[model samples]
Target: MTRSYDEWKAAAAAMEFDGRPVIGGVRVAARSGETIAKTNPATGEVVSQIHACGQEDVDAAVAAARAAYEAGEWSRAGAGFRRERLLAFAGLIEEHADELALFDSLDMGKPVREAAAIDAPGSAALYRFYGEAIEKAEDLIPVTPPGSTALVTREALGVVAVIVAWNYPLEIATWKLAPALAAGNSVVVKPPVEASHSTLLLAELAIRAGIPAGVLNVVTGRGSAVGRSLALHEDVDMLAFTGSTEVAKQLQQYAGQSNMKRLALEAGGKSSNLIFADCDDLRLAAQKAAFGSFYNQGEVCSANSRIFVERSVYPEFLELYAEAARAYAPGDPLDPETGIGALVSEAHADTVWATIERARRDGTIAAGGTRPEINGSRAFIEPTIVTDVPADHEVHTREIFGPVAVVAPFDSEDEAVARANETPYGLAASLWTGSLARAHRVSQRLVAGTVSVNTVDALGFTTPFGGFKQSGFGRDLSVHALENYTDYKTTWMQWG
Candidate 1:
C-alpha cells in the first residue's frame, strides 16, 4: 500500500527477463533460442521478452527434474529439511511481495493494489501451509494378521509438471507447486505464456529460498509447445494443472497416450450463487453475489456466473447486484482508486464479449453490457448483469470468464437446487439463507466441490477447492491436495 504508481513503474522498467530459462539450477537459453512477448493487458505494451521453450526445452527440464529426483537431493532430504527449506522459500516470497505483486499486475493487467493484497501474499501463505504440513505428516500403521506387522508410507511421485492459466498466475501455481514440492517431488511449472514474468521471478526466488536447482523449473511458452511436451513426457510422473476444461482434457489425453502419469486437475466452472427466500442481510448477500461473479474482472474459474434468486427476492437482489456492478467501472489497473482492472489480454477480452453478445440474443442485459472506453483493444468490460436468461442459455451454462453474470429466479428449494445443478460444471456454489435445516439440506443436494452458506467466494488456506463433472476432478489448496503428489506403499514383515 505504501508504494506509489511511480514505484511500480520503476520496478517494471527495471525487471530483467535476462535470466532466460532456469535449468539444473542455472539460467539458460532455450534450444530454439525463441522468445515470447508478454504485454500489459491494460496498455497493450510489451512488458518483457520471455524465452519460449518447445519440445527440446521440455525434454531438458524434465531430464533435469528426473535427475534431481533420482539423486535424492530434495526428495530424500527428509521431511524436516524440506519443511525448513519450503518455509525459507515462503519467507522470500513475503520479503519481495511488493515487487512480485507489481510483476503480476504489470504482466496481466490486474489492479496493482488488488494483486498485492490477494495473489502475492496468498501465494506465500500457501507455501507456508504446505511447509508446516510436511512436518506433521506421518506414515500409517496398517492392520495385519497377528504374526505380521504392516506399515504404509507415502512416497513422492518423481517429477510433477504443473500447467496453470493466465488468471491468478502466482496464486494458482503456488496451489500446485507447494504440495508437490512438500511431498518431495521435483516440478516443471508451465505458467500461462501470456503472464510469465511473475512466475519467472517466483522461480528465481525459489532458488534463493534454498530449493535445489532442478527441484523447481519454469518453462514459458504457448500451451501447444512447452505444455504439450511436458505433459507427454514419460519421465514426468505426475501432472497437476489449473486451467480450462478443454485444456485439462488434452493434458489427460497426453498422459494416457504417454505414461499414464497421475493427473490432478482443477478446471473451469460455471458456478452458481443461490439466494434463498429467507436470506440473511439481503443487501450484503446481493453485494457478495455480485463480487463473487465479477471479482478479478470475473476471471475466476469459480466465478458465480449463474445467480439463482428465490422468486420472492429476485427483483430486489437484482437491483442491489446491479448497484454493486456499477461501482466496478473499468479503469486503469495502476490507479489505486480503480476497481475493475483490464481483462487479462485483448484476445481473451474479445472472447468474453463474444459470449456476452451471444447471451444478448436470448437474455436481457440488466446493466453494464457495453464495453468501456479503454486505451488498449478489448481491454475492459463494464461489470455486466444479465437477467431473464434461460436455464440452458450459454451465459447460464458456460463459463464466460469475464465480468458478466446471469441472474434468474427459482420458486422452490428443490427448484433452486435443480437449477443450480443443471449445468455440466459443479465447481463451487453459494447458498444464502438463515434456515439451518434448509442450508444443510440444500447444500447436500447441490452438486459442487465447494459450497458456501450465507457467503460467497469463501475460500482459504485450510480447505480443498475443486469441482465435479466436466468442471474436472481433484482438489487444490489445503493438505488434501498433497495426495495428488504422493502414493502409498505398504510393507509387510513377519516377526520372530
Candidate 2:
C-alpha cells in the first residue's frame, strides 16, 4: 500500500535529531569548531547542525576504520556472524524507517513521502541483499594442468571510505556501505555535509544493531575539507564515491597521489529516453519520462533528461510529456501529495532556475520555465520542459540538476542513437519501442553502462549499476558490486 500524504507529514513532525558527527562509533564535534548548518530548503530555516569536520576529523575516522579492520572483528568475522549482525542492522533501520526518512527529507529537501517510501526501505533492502550474498559467496578451485591445484579466494580490502551524494542520501550511502561491510571491510562514510543527518542517524542504528565501534564511522563536513582529506588519506585502502564526474576524477588523482588506493566511482548522467512512433505504450513512456526527469526534482544522476521522440509522433508526445510535467508542481516536501520539493540548496536552485532562464532564451519553454511561489518566496521550481532547443545548447549538453526536461525530435533510429551519445555523459539510457530487435540493436550501439527497454531510469539494487566514459566507472549494486570492495587472491600448490 502506498503511504498517504498525512502520514508523511506526521513522520516529519515526529522527526528528531541529535546533531553530531559519529566518529569511531561515538557522537562528537569538529576539532576546529566548524559546523555544517542544515537549512531546510522547504522553509529556508536552519533546522539542525552537524560537526563540520576537517583534516583532523578525517584522520581520526580513518584511524578508527583502520584500527577496526586490523582488529579483524568485523573484517575477519565469520559469514554467519556478519549475516546475523547485518540482518539486525537492516531490521533496526526498518524499525526506525520513519526517522531516517524524516532526516533525509529535512536535510536534502527530498519529498518526505519519497524519503519514507523509497530511500528508507531501499537502504534496508540493500543491507539484507548483501548480507545474504556474503553468507553464500563461495571460493573456487581451478583445475590444474598437472599435479598442482590453484585456488582463488576473495578477501576484504581493509579500510574503505565511502562518499555519497546528497540527492539520495541514505539509499546511495547504503549502496557502498552495505557492500563494503559485507565484503568484510571497515568503512568511513563521508556524507555530503548538508545532508549528514540521515547518515548520522544510520550510524546510531548500526551501533544498536551491535556493530562495534570503528567498524562503521561517519565524518560529516564540507567536501572540500573532510572529503578531500579522506580521499587523500593513505590509511583508507579503497574509496567508493557517488557524485559528479568532475569530483570522481579528482578523487582518482587523490588516490594516485596517496597510496594508489582502489576507487569505485558512480558519477553523473544525462540519460536519454528515446520514444519511437512504434512504441507500444507512449503514455507509460511519457509518464516515466516525466518521472525519470522530475523525480527527486531531477537530482538523480541517471535522470532521463533528454527525451527524443520519433518525428512522426513528436508533437503528440511533447504535449503528453508537458502534461506529465505540469502534474509535478513543487510543494512543501512535507506535503505527501507534492510531486516535487525544494532543491538541496538555494544556490543549486538558483543554478537550476538560471538554466531554465537560459532555456527560455534558447528554446521554447514548453511547459514550465520559472520558479514557483511558496509562501511568497521562490525556494521551489515548477517542473520545467523545454522544446525547440538547439542540440548544442548547454541545457542540452550539461547536467542541469533540476526538475527540467529537454525534448527534441529525431527522424531515424540512427539519428536518435547518435544524438543520445552527444553529451559527455554515458550513465544510463532507455528506449521505447515495440520491435525487440531494434531495442537490442540500439542498446548495443549506445555508449551508456546500462540501457533499459521501454523504461526510463530502471535501477535496482539487484543489478550492477555504473556509468561509461566521463560518467565514471564501477558497478554499485548486485553481487558484482562486491568486487569493487574486495580483492581476489590466487594460490598455487603442488599436492603430488
Candidate 3:
C-alpha cells in the first residue's frame, strides 16, 4: 500500500479547507499582506502558502473570541447546548478523517497511516469524550456547612489562546481545543507556522459544525509575531501551549506581564524506559521501547529516549531493540506501509544528526548512526539506538526530539529509578517488569507525570496528561483540562 508521489500530490490538491481560514464566520487573510510557504518536510516541496498573520490579525482574532465570550451565546449557553455543538464538531472531524490525515502527513511528515489511525482518530475521540463529559458536569457537591447553602459552579475563563507545536500539530491542537471548547471557552488558536494548514482546516470544520462565530479562531504566523500577540493579549484569559521548556518559560513571562492569564504548558521531556531482568516479555518490551522512542521521527515530547536495561539481560535486550529499530525505516509518508517518515524539516534533521554526532563523540554508538537514502530530497533520518552513553551526556539529559535512543545498563532497581529521575524533565517514564511488587515500587519512585507499566505510550483521552518539574505544569485532554479552562465560583447567601 505504498502511495506514489502522484497519488500523494493528487490527494493534497483535492483536500479543501472550506474556503479560507475562518474568524468569526468571516473568511479572512492576514491584514499585513505577508505570506509563508508551507513546505513538505519529506520532500522540501512547497505544499501551499498561507497568509502570515501579524499583530493586527492577532488583535482581530482575539477581539472575535472576546466578543464571543462576552456575548455568552457559546460559553454562557446551557451546558447541554454546548454539548450538542461539540458532538457535531466531533462528527465532522470523523467525517473528514481522510482530508485531515492527508493534510497532517503533508504538513508534518508523519506517515499517513499513523496520522489517520492514531492522530486523527484520537482527536475525534477526544472531542467526543470531552463533549459527553461536559454534559454530565454539574454542581453536585455543596460547599456550605450543615443546611446552609453555597453553590459551586464552573464558569468559562473567557477567551483562551492555544499555541500548539509543529511536531503533532493537529493532534495536540485537538487536545487543547476539545476540552477548552467543551468547557465553553472561546479559543484563539496559534498553530505553529511550520504546520498550520491542517489547524486552519480544523477551524473551518468547527464553523461547519455549528460552532458560534468567533468561538474558534485560527491565526497563522511565526511564534514571535502572532504567538507573542496571543500570549500577551489582554483579552486572552488563558494560554495553553505545548513545546520546548525554553519557550514555555518565555510564555510564562508573557502571561505574567499581561493579565496573569492561566497557563497550561506541556513542554519537553527526557523520559526513561526501564526494563528489568525479571520481565518475561523481553521481546515485547524491546519492540515497544524501540517504537516508543523512534515513532514520529522522535518528535514526540514524551518519547522514552533514555532506556535503562537491567545488567543481567542488557546485551540480549540491546540486540532485540536494535533489530526493532531497524524495522522502522524512513519511507514516503503517504505510503500506508511506511512505519516511519521524515523529520519534519531538513534543518530539524540536521539538528538531530548533530545531536547524534555529539552523542557518538562522548559515548559508544550502538546501532544506527547514519542517515538513510530517500527517493526525494526530504528530511529523512535513520532510526538510531546508542549504548554506553554516560548519564551526564547531553543526549541522555536533553530532549534530542528525533529518532534516537540512548541505552544505558543498570544493575538494580534503585539505580534505574535514580537514572530515570536524573534529568530536569519529569514528563513520562515506562517500566517493563513481571513482578507486581516491583512494578508498584518502580512506578512510585519514578518522578514523572505519567508512568507506563509494561506499556509504552498508552495515552488515552480520559486520562489527565501533563508534566512535572521543568517539563511544565497543568493538564490537557481530560476533565483536568476542563478545569484548566474554567474558574470556580462559590456563591454564599444568608437566609433572611
Clashes of each: 0, 0, 1
What C-alpha lDDT, on a 0 to 100 scale, does residue 204 get in candidate 2? Answer: 87
Worst lDDT 10-window in candidate 3: 13-22
Candidate 2 lDDT, tens digit per residue, 137-185? 9999988878899999999989999998999999989999998989899
**Native-to-model Cα distance after best TM-score fit, residue 346 in candidate 3, in Å:** 0.1
Score residue 479 of candidate 3 by CA lDDT: 84
* Candidate 1 vs 3: which has more TM-score: 1
Give candidate 1 regions above 4 Å deviation: none
lDDT tens string, model 3, 1-496? Answer: 4346577667877875422346786779788878887788878878777778888888888889988888988977887888888889888888878788888888889898887777877788888888889999988456666656887888888899999998898899999999899888999998887788778888888888888989999888889998889888888999999999999999999999989999999999999999999998999999999889999989999999999999999999999999898878889888766768888888888899998898788788888888865756548888888777667888888898899999989988889999999999999999999999999998999999999999996677678888899999999766888888998998877674
Q: TM-score of model 3 relative to the true fold?
A: 0.96
Worst 10 residues of 2 by lDDT: 370-379
- Candidate 2 Cα errors over 4 Å, as ranges: 1-14, 145-147
- Taking all chains together, each candidate's TM-score versus the true structure is 0.97, 0.97, 0.96
Instruction: Tell me the deviation in Å of residue 288 in model 1.
Output: 0.2
Best candidate according to lDDT: 2
Model 1 Cα lDDT, one tens digit per residue, 1-496: 5667677667667766552777777778888888888788888887678888889888888899999999998999988899988899988988888787777787778888888887888888888899999889999887888989989998998999999888898888899999999999999999888777777888888889889889999887889998899888988899998888999889989999999999998888999889988987999998888789888899999998888989998889888889888777888887777778899888888998888887787778899889875765568899888887666678877788899998888889888888898987889999999999999999999899999999887888889899999888888988889999999999999984
Clashing pairs in 3: 42-378
The alpha-carbon deviation from the true structure for residue 120 of candidate 2, after best TM-score superposition, in angstroms, is 0.8
